[model samples]
Target: MIIQMEGISKSFSGNQVLKEVAFSLEKGEIHALMGENGAGKSTMMKILTGIYARDSGTVEVKGKQVVYKGPKDAERDGIAVIHQELNILPELTVAENLYLGNEQTVGKTAWLKTKEMNRKTEETLRDLGLHVKATERAGNLSVGKQQMIEIAKALMTNADVIIMDEPTAALTDREIQTLFKTIRGLQEKGVSFIYISHRMEEIFSLCDRITVLRDGQYVGVKNIPETSFDEIVSMMVGRQLGGRFPELTNEPGDVKLEVKGLTRMGEFKDISFAVKSGEILGISGLMGAGRSEVVETLFGYRKAESGQILINGKEVQISSPIEAIRNGLGLITEDRKTKGLITDFSIRENISLANLKSISTNGWIAKKKESALFENLIKRLRVVCSSPEQQAKSLSGGNQQKVVIAKWLGTSPSILILDEPTRGVDVGAKKEIYTIMKELAEQGVAIIMVSSELPEVIGMSSRVMVMFEGQMKTILDRNELSEEHIMHYATGGDKHVG
Candidate 1:
């Protein structure tokens, strides 16, 4: 065994994240940590890396008890973590980044050996089978390539135990395959890994053993080949998944929105799509492929230089989100923490934000009416909170998303746009969100959803539209859309798509 964690428990403020979570890693093995969002996987890893101090636990790394005060302590102990968010200075070159803090200085800082450092950087990237130029700026690379650089940096530091959190979340099929090959080679060289991710196929295909967590508790540990996905999901969920995506199709009525030649200088160009009442249209693409930009433009957050927006078949000029809202459009932005909710406000306050005018009576605010409305919505949405008075930030990520959705529900817009609605939500909350979307559709609400999860787009969407590098690619009927096909089109590989 390479690492053994016993009775590990961590708490944030008063909230318990990991409760007696126990797991182990073996030498040269890829152990997968499976759980939904906010399930304490990251917290446990942070404890190991000393980013967090565990409330109570005993951790043995390499058969020796370890106490780490910070990431540097963990680094010296041969443990490294590559978070989902890559930490890199954009303006710096690859060589400069590789030797960022520990730079070689001649004569105690008279000058540094740029040529020598660049040569070493070239060797490091080449060792990973990548041709990334040493002098190239870090921000110039794709997300996939940037992830590879992060991995290379970890290796350059001579880490024995590597914990990769969602390393392939944004990578393409080919890039993922390349990553798998690299992982296998590293494994052969005696480096162990703990991979945390949500993709079922990748977990089974890449991991040696799968450790499941549910609601901050360890469910079970099973060998990869012996355990089926159905069994693993059952363990993680603690109940059988009875049709994860509920069947609640509503008839798409008259067109609620029509966009013609929607253009925004260099963001997205000549984009055109119409959404009808009760239809859930999914938009998908690589991270920077203009999926969010197009919808943002439609919502009037970004001005479209050349576009004719027809809501309910009437042309409207919307210069801002307020104007768009007045024209019956609602947009749920991608990032909830920074953009979605008012964390300082109570649940009721956040829920009633979008329709303050409607909730208020005449010139004065109607407190009773607002409370009654939010109470009804709270029960309907199943927002897990102590009460309506609870702060929005006190709720979980999934609940926060539900609150945002509830807030928008008050607007009663003819068309709704959801950007990465289920990005950080757990499986159960995700199911609830799907159910709510279906119910809204049944009630004749038009919804446009942007999701990076291919399964979400394919499963929940009545129709799917793909975007590639600043342009609309192809739109497919639900029956015709597959993960592979959507990916092909979204990445500008029409040859593979058709």
Candidate 2:
């Protein structure tokens, strides 16, 4: 075995998050660690990487017991962790970011060997099938490229056992394939990996063995070939989940929102689409194909150089978010940590932020009104938390996303735009989100979902709009929706296939 942990237990502030969990990874194996939000998957890995000291446990590396004081100690022992949120300085060049703190120097002096480092960076990236200039700024690259950079860092450290958390959450399809290829190549070289992701399809296809965790306790471990998706999901949630996606029963009504000639120069151009009162319009494309940009323009976050936005058959000039809200538009932004919530605030505070005017009495806020709103939303959304007073940042990613949705639901929008609604969420949470969207749609709310996941777009959308190079290529009916068809339009392929 490459590593093993038994009887692991941990807690924070008397709240037990992990209890007697056990895991094992063999050399050159891709092991998947899976659970719902707050299920102790991350905690177990943290303890393994020395980010958190376990209260009680035994961890063995290559048959020797070891307790690492910190991540550096673990790294020195050939264990590296690449977190979900990448650690890359945007302003720094790729070479600089790659060689950070371990830069090559000239003959024991402070002068750097920039040329040599850049050459090495290019070579390393090329090995991983990533083609980019080493001198270019790291931030300019797509999320996928930045992720590859993190893996490159791990390889440079000669890490034998690497742990990746939600690695493909923001990657395009091509990028995911590239990442999978790189991982398989590394595995062939005897580099074992612990892959953490909520994507079941990915785990089933790429991983060799799977270990399931539920509510901080060890569930069971099974070989990928021996286990089924239904069994793994049942193991994770402790019950059978009826369907992968809930039934969409919302019937289409009149067009509630329309955009004609929506132009944003370099971002998107001449986008035209209409969403009915009770319809779900899905937007699908590659990373920079302007899926989010179109929604952002509609929400008044970006100014449209030329466009006519009609809501309820009346043209409205929405120049700001305040105006968008006034015109009955609610946007759940893509980046929840930065754009959706105040991380430092409590759940009640975050939920009431968008509808402060409604929850407030004159100039002052009404505590009772805010509390009632918080209670109602949490119960309705089934957000798991200690209390409404719990800090937003302390909640799991799935709960944090619920709070963002709750914040917007308070506005009671006639038109709702959700961007990557279940990007980093687990299968259980994803069903809950889909249920909520279905309920909203049934109540006559027009929803525009911008998603990269083709299955989600195909499953939920009443009509799908595919974009390519910032322009609307083709919009397909629900019957015509398929991964191949969407990719054809998304990649600027000819509309009529031969």
Candidate 3:
């Protein structure tokens, strides 16, 4: 075994998070760690990477029991972990980030070797089958490119073991294929990898072995070729999933939104669509195809050069989100952490922010009414919390998205736009959200869903709209929504009218 963790135990405040967890890995093999949220997967990885001191455990690397104090110690021992939460300096270039630790020499800092670093970074990117410039600012890159950079950082370290948590959560299917190829290449070169994910398809595709952890305990480990998706999911949830999705039978109502000639130069042009009550319309496109920009303009966050928006067949000017909301429009932004919710505010405060006018009397917030609203939404959305006073930042990604949806629900908008509604969420949470969305639509709300996941867009959208190079391609009905057809439209290979 290249690595072995035996009898690992950890806890906080007398609550055990990991109990007697055991795991092992070998060279040239991809080991998968499967678990639910707060099931101690992150905790186990933290202990392995020296982020936390294990309560009682023995870690043997290549048959040698070692002691580590911190991340630097782990790094020196050839262990690297790419955390789920991105940790990149926004202002730093890719080359700078790659060589950040090696910036200074033993004696003094020399004239910062820019050319050598650039050359090495370029070489690394090509090696990983990615085409990112080294001098470009890390913050300017898309989430997929940023993820490639993180992987490059690990490769540059020449670490023996690379631990990745939800690596494909941000990448496209093609990018994920490239990543898997790179992982195989590295594995052949004797670098072992530990992959963690809730997606069983990805696991069966990439991993050699699977380890199931539930409720801080090891359920079992199985070979990929021998295990089935049903087996894995049952082990994780401790039962068979009743149904992947809930029954949604909502009748169509009158059109609540109409957009015509929506154009944003260099982003999207001449985009026209209408969403009716009790309908979920999905918008899909390749990265940089302007799906987000179109939605942003429709929501009044970006200016549309030549467009006419009408709510209920009446022309209206929507210069800002406030105006849009007043005209019965609500938007759940793509980047939830930045644009969806206020991370610093309490759950109640965030949930009630959109309808503050309704909850205020004479410019004074009605505290009691606000409390009732908070409690109501929390219950309605099934937000996992002990009280409404919990900070929004304290919840998980899925719960945060629920809070954002609840916030928009407060205003009672007739049309709701959810951009990447299930982005960065677990499968269980994704199903939960889909149920909520279906329920909302069944209640006569118009929904516009923008998603990059092909399966998700096809599964949830009653109709799918494809965009390529800032132009809307053919709008497809649910029956015509196949992965190949969607990809063709998304890649501008299909006939279209701008």
Candidate 4:
């Protein structure tokens, strides 16, 4: 085995986050770590990489026990981690970001080999089918491109053992295939990978073995060919989740929000749609198809060159997010870490940030009202946190996403827009989110969900609107929803709308 851990245990402030977990990775094997958020998957990997010291455990590398004081030490031993949260420095160039601390130096002198590094960066990216200029500013690229940069950064390490956390969360289908190909190539060279993702399709297709964790404890390990999806899910969530998506009983009423020829200069053009009360209008499209840009324009995050936004049959002006909220529209942005919540704020503060009017009186905040709101929403969403005072950044990715949803829920908006609502969420939490979405729709909230996952769009949408290259191709009804049909329209199969 290339790596092994026995009886791993860890805790924070007396709260046990991991307990007696065990894992092993064979050389050149693609091992999958499966668990719900806060189930100790990331924690286990952190301990393995010396990001967090285990309270009690034995970690062996190539049959020898080792203790790494920091991630750099672990890197020296051929273990590199690409964390779920990206580590890219946005302000730097692609080449600069790739070689940040590991730059090529001229012997013992401080002179750098810039030309060689850029050329190497270009070659590495090209190998992964990423066609970005090494001199381009990393911040200007799309999230999908940025994620590819992360993968490229990890590959540049030339580590024998690599751990990827949700590596394809932002990647396109083409990019994912390229990544898999790259991974297989590395495996052929005797490199091993510890793959972490909530995507079951990837696990089934790419991984060799699986290790399941539940509630911070080890479940069991199984070979890829020997285990079934149902069994693996049952083990991870500790219960049978009846259906991947809950039944939507909501019937559409009068239109709550409408856009007429919404045109944004270089992004999207002449976008038109209407979402009725108690209905979900799912926006489906490929990367750079302007799905997000359309929504951003509607939410006033981007300016529309020309368009008319009609909220409840009357044209309304939305020049900013504040105005959007004032008009009873709430947007759960795509990038939750940057746009959705303030990581430095506590749960109580973040939740109250959007609904101060309901919890305040005459310019003074009501503590009891705020606390009640926090408690009620936290319990409702099943957010895993020690207390309301816990920093938003401290929660797991899934929990942080739930908190973002809760913050918007507090606004009690008539129209709610969720952009990639469950991107990195596990199966169990996804069901809960679907339930909440259903409940809100039943209560007459119009939901606009933009998703790249076809299953989610097909399962939740009342109507799916496929966009191709900034134009609406077609909108299919629930009875007409299918992955094949959606993909056809998404790729400009038919140019007719409605």
Best of the two (2, 4) by TM-score:
4
Give the distance in Å from residue 32's predicted Cα in candidate 1 to where it truly belongs: 1.8
Please report the candidate that would top lDDT against the real structure.
4
Q: By TM-score, highest first, what's the ranking? A: 4, 2, 3, 1
Provide TM-scores for the models: 0.83, 0.95, 0.91, 0.96
Better of 1 and 4 by TM-score: 4
Question: lDDT tens digits, residues 334-359, model 3?
Answer: 76777898988989889888989879
In the range 387-430, model 4's lDDT, one tens digit per residue, is: 88999999998899999999999999999999999978888999
Query: Which of 2 and 3 is the better model by TM-score?
Result: 2
Clashing pairs in 2: none
lDDT of 3 at 43: 82
Least accurate 10 contiguous residues by lDDT in model 3? 102-111
**Alpha-carbon runs more than 4 Å astray in model 1:** 11-16, 84-107, 110-156, 168-178, 341-355, 361-403, 491-498
lDDT of 2 by residue, 32-67 (tens): 999998899888998998889999989999899999
Model 2 vs. true fold: TM: 0.95
Residue runs of model 3 more than 4 Å from their true location after superposition: 104-108, 126-132, 379-382, 496-498
lDDT of each: 0.82, 0.89, 0.82, 0.91
lDDT of 4: 0.91
